[model samples]
Target: MTDKLKDKIEKFLAMCLKSKSEKEGDTSIKVDELTEEQHREIAEDAVAITNSLVELQRLLPVSRKLAELGYLLEVQGKITVKAGEAYDEAALNFFSDMYGGGIALSKRLH
Candidate 1:
């Protein structure tokens, strides 16, 4: 890792450690005292976790809408389970923006 990135990660770890120590009334943890391997491992894990959280946040809205659609379909008795599958393939096409437009255009061209 670049020195700048390592420095930032070290600073962030120190701040987090200080805050946690204050909350738990323990001041023994120090970022500067960590071995190089430990520090590198923590930094890598932190970045990976942050990326996963960001991806989940971005997908949350789409997932919510899909859930709502499923509920409405179930309530109306419009969807059925087949061989333990929760959703039908055709019903899911409704949520695709390109589905309707593409089908209509293809029908027109053919």
Candidate 2:
């Protein structure tokens, strides 16, 4: 990685190392007090949270777009998920702007 990232990581590691105060100023953040089962559980929990974070990152944009479409449709006073301009024009335009055109219209016309 870059020197800036490396420096930041080194600084963080230094901070972590200095988080303990015991035995004549020897600073070591040890998990020796923690049981092996607890350590395994903590690692499993971390991995689960990391996986959830990855999925959330992947889904956030799609969820945001869906929320935007819902808001646009509701502002135009329609909440139904229909498939045509007959229900909500603003929602149609919101999606058409992304995909370049309406799929139904393209299928019917071309």
Candidate 3:
């Protein structure tokens, strides 16, 4: 990727992280009484993150790699007893092996 594209990717990833953090904070805030405006604000933030996630899925291979890793972690130990359960773990391991693990994958992609 060009340096400019790489910078854009990094900024996008930072936005993803920030959105996630904000969502977590919003969840906590939701316990308190919220006005309609506040509720709309929270909903809009969630929608923004969801839309960004969809865009990232299209734009970044690393996002897929990380998602596969998460799936693999969820299913790694139960492959033999349950093939369905193993799918996630196998996928995670496959991506990790394919890309030399998460850190390397992110660095190489960005």
Candidate 4:
């Protein structure tokens, strides 16, 4: 897929896939394009920082969208608060798969 297309798909996934605030909804698509591993890989990289603070802000909204938002690190299976963490720290702990966190895909999928 082209870069533009990838970005669009990623954005759609984020919006439709739902979060704590976004309730479950119907989403139907014939996704034979990307393999399961590919999908996982893309998601793993979904919250990557581009060295842009504006982009970084998405993972750590200053208005405290992440206030009630707590990360449930997969490996540890514990909730980490986002209240007072720095932007980078919040982003890393909240969305870094390498460290057992990231918008929990399993929770989002279910």
Among all candidates shown, the one with the greatest lDDT: 1
lDDT of 3 by residue, 1-110 (tens): 99998776556545544565597774333223446675466557767988998997885676566556666555675223245454445665665676675566668788
Using lDDT, rank the candidates from best to worst. 1, 2, 3, 4
- Between candidates 1 and 4, the TM-score winner: 1
> TM-score per candidate, in order?
0.52, 0.42, 0.29, 0.21
Q: Residue 9: error of model 4 in Å?
A: 5.3
Worst 10 residues of 4 by lDDT: 66-75
- Give the top-scoring candidate (TM-score): 1
Candidate 4 C-alpha lDDT tens digits along 54-95: 566665554354333333242255445455664445544555
Predictions in order: lDDT: 0.71, 0.61, 0.60, 0.51
Clashing pairs in 2: none
Q: Candidate 2's residue-wise lDDT over 20-97, tens digit each? A: 335348754445554567557655765787799999999777677766777767777755555553423455556666
Name the regions of candidate 4 deviating beyond 4 angstroms.
1-31, 49-55, 58-110
Q: Candidate 3 — which pairs collide?
A: 72-88, 72-89
Task: Kindly report which residue stretches of model 2 are placed more than 4 angstroms away from their true locations once superposed.
Answer: 1-29, 80-110
State residue 6's C-alpha deviation in candidate 3, in Å: 38
Candidate 1, superposed: residue stretches over 4 Å from native: 1-8, 15-29, 80-110
With a 3 Å backbone cut-off (N, CA, C), the pairs that clash in candidate 1 are none
Q: How well does candidate 1 score on lDDT at residue 77? A: 79
What's the best-to-worst order under TM-score?
1, 2, 3, 4
